[model samples]
Target: MNVVEMLQEEKVVAVLRRLPSETFLDVVRALAEGGVRAIEVTMDAPDGAELIRRTREVLGDRVLLGAGTVFTREQMQAAKEAGATFFVSPHLDSDLMHAAREWGVPMVPGVLTPTEVAAALRLGAEAVKIFPGSLVGPGYLRDLRGPFKDLKAMVTGGVNEDNARAFLDAGAVAVGVGSSLFPRTDLEARDFASITKRAERLVRAVRG
Candidate 1:
């Protein structure tokens, strides 16, 4: 399946930021073992592009890989070349969205208001990610749907097992979970088991 189809199927995007290259595969393994099928490696992470490439080689088509924190058209193209199946950003950028469309990569651009969401959709984005989702809560999603009923919104930031279900129940297509799902301290301790447990909990929350 393509990235868009995969996102629709999984309904969750596990964002990995600040993860060491050495532990990247281990993290992917833990999440995959816990039934998580989509993962995003942020460009801010060390060797993020290389990690994405390696992950594609290691997991093949079993997992959907994406690049996050992409800020420019060049970065989007590079990510695609590095085997990123999708693109994500913390803010909506028309240029980046256009590049993603040109590459045929599923784009999930961040938006904080109805105007931005409309702009993103106009650019052909498959979905819009609501950043700082904690602040707005699921209620914001419900409100946005009122104006853009056709928009597919994913809530990120401060999304944890405690409130993941709330976001989904509120009508979000998916949620981009970061530190709450992939804690850096725990991973550094080589606690792959803990990561697996967290992933499992998140899976349950999203499913619920």
Candidate 2:
């Protein structure tokens, strides 16, 4: 499905960062069982390329794989070859935005203010990701609604069950959950079921 369709349908993006290689497949499976399909595997991870490739091969179209923390053209290219059709970064770089457009890859560049949001839109970004969103809180998103009511926003950072719904209610089209969804304890214990339960709870909180 397209990014817009995926966002509207799933309303959540589980950000997997530097996840253990051994349990990567199981992690994805757990997330899927809870009805979360959009997954962003950080490119900066130790074995990102292999993970991306394997995720694509194993999940097929069952999940929408994205390359996150992607900043350079080389990184984007590597991710593309590894089966990531979409890209996400921590900052809004005009060049990176243009590069993604040229590559025909949907890139969600991060933004912290209205000016950056407008710049991203002009650069042809399909959507803008609000980084460190937890620090800014739901009010920040609510404030952006006036000038960017028509745009789609993804809140990444500091999102948990406590505030996932608040972010979505405020204006975020989708919320990206990292450590909150995949706790280190559960991962270490190979508690895939717990991961699935967490994902289910988060999904329900936002989309219910």
**RMSD to truth, every model:** 1.4, 1.0
**110: Cα error in model 1, Å:** 0.7
**Tens digits of lDDT, candidate 2, 1-208:** 6786687678899899999899999999999999899999998976887899999999998988899998789999999999997999999998888888888889999999999999999998878899999789999999998878887889999999899999888988898999999888999899999999999998889889
lDDT of each: 0.84, 0.90
lDDT of 1 by residue, 1-208 (tens): 6555567678778898867777879989988888888889898764878888988998888878889999978777777888998888999888787777787788888889888888888888878889989999999898889888877778899998888888888888788888887776787798988889999988877776
Tell me how far the alpha carbon of residue 26 in candidate 2 is from the true structure, in angstroms, after superposition. Answer: 1.0
TM-score, per-candidate, Cα-based: 0.94, 0.97
* Model 2: residues with Cα > 4 Å off, grouped in runs: none
Residue 141 of model 2 has an lDDT of 93
C-alpha-based local distance difference test score of model 1: 0.84
- Mind sharing the TM-score for model 2? 0.97
What's model 2's lDDT at 172?
Answer: 84
Using TM-score as the measure, which candidate wins? 2
